[model samples]
Target: MLLSGHCLIVLERTVLAASPAEGCALLIGRRHAEALWVQRIWPCCNRWEPASERQRHFQLDPREQLLAQRWVRERGLQVLGAAHSHPSSPAVPSLSDRERSLGPTLLLIRSGLTDDPHPLRAWWLPEPAALPGPAPEALPLPLEAPLTGDLGE
Candidate 1:
């Protein structure tokens, strides 16, 4: 996926802002040829139920998602996928993440390790039931930061 440095910064800040809780956003952009260009990110509140599981789970506000869809449609962009932060884990997707994914799309996960040179990672996940076996491993996608060398871990 191709993302600008500014967008990366925005994603990091938005997700990290949640600190102990998880934060999420929708990736807004266009898909051209084989590349997905992330034009922007729409930050969303983590509305996971029970409140206590917010640290390990996230649910985009339905209202915000609808609004974001409208905004993207108006701008001729698509909601490429979703993004979220793992406040206490690595940039890799957790089992829960993979199990919950509706996929065949990109997923960007940011690690809590701020000091790490590359704290964010991207993955391409298949549909949950696309295969009959155990959940398939997510395919890693290289996150290219054109102006900033600060992504992927």
Candidate 2:
């Protein structure tokens, strides 16, 4: 996937600011050929129950998701997928993440509160039925930078 320069910055700042809680956002963009180009970052609230688990888990607010879907539809864009931060773990998908993922979609994770070696990563989760067994395996995907646009919309 190719992220607009602005999207990347917004993602970084959002995740950084959400230190104690997991920051979440919806990726809005259009697909061309096999690549998804991110045009905007629609920030969302993490509404996981039991505030104590906020650090290790995140639930994207359903209301925000519905609103995002409507907003993107109006702009001829798609809700590509989602992004979230991992306060203390690496950027890779955790066991719960793999099991919870509704696949054939993109999932971006930002690890650590600070700039760790692998602060950010993306994964492609396949459709559950497509898997050979019960195990959920997420394939790593690249997060690329586009050639222009440093400011976000």
Candidate 3:
């Protein structure tokens, strides 16, 4: 997965703003050859009902996800990935997270609110599981940033 620097900043700010609640967003970009490059990050609400606590769980509203799908199509881009914050924990997927996950979607998890870049991690979930499986292994998704000496955006 590739994310531009601008989009990453926006994602961090959005996630931090949500604070104790799990913030979620749709990663938007297109596929080129074999890689996904993220061009936009669309922030959405947590919308998980009856959350006695939101520090560890999040449910993306169906409506917002559908809208995001439509927007992706209209923009001629694909849903490059999904992202969420992990409020009080690490960026690793929880047991519940692994059980509910669908494969082949790149997932970005931000563990804490710090501006330092150490809290984020990415994973690739393989899809169409015949049964619920163990947590998908984590991936080393590098933040897609412009290299030095490149022209400004």
Candidate 2 yields a Cα-based lDDT of: 0.79
Q: Write the per-residue lDDT of candidate 1 for residues 1-153, one digit (tens) a residue.
A: 788777888898999999899989999999998788988999999999989999989988999999999999998999999999999888777778877888877899998876755578888778877544454444444456456454563
From the highest TM-score down, the ranking of the candidates is 1, 2, 3
Model 3 lDDT per residue over 64-152, tens place: 88999999898798887778899877888776666566756778889884563659887776774633666666776666766456334
Q: Ten consecutive residues with minimal summed lDDT in candidate 1?
A: 131-140
Q: Which model, 2 or 3, shows the larger lDDT?
A: 2
In candidate 1 the C-alpha lDDT for residue 5 amounts to 76
TM-score of 2: 0.84
Q: List the residue pairs that clash in candidate 2.
A: none
Say what the RMSD of model 1 is: 4.1
Task: Report every candidate's CA lDDT.
Answer: 0.83, 0.79, 0.78
Identify the leading candidate in terms of TM-score. Answer: 1
Candidate 1 off by > 4 Å: 114-117, 131-153
lDDT by residue for model 2 (1-153), tens: 777666888987777677778998988899898888878888988898898898988888999999999999899999888899998888877767766667777788898746677687777677756554454444444446554643435
Ranking by lDDT: 1, 2, 3
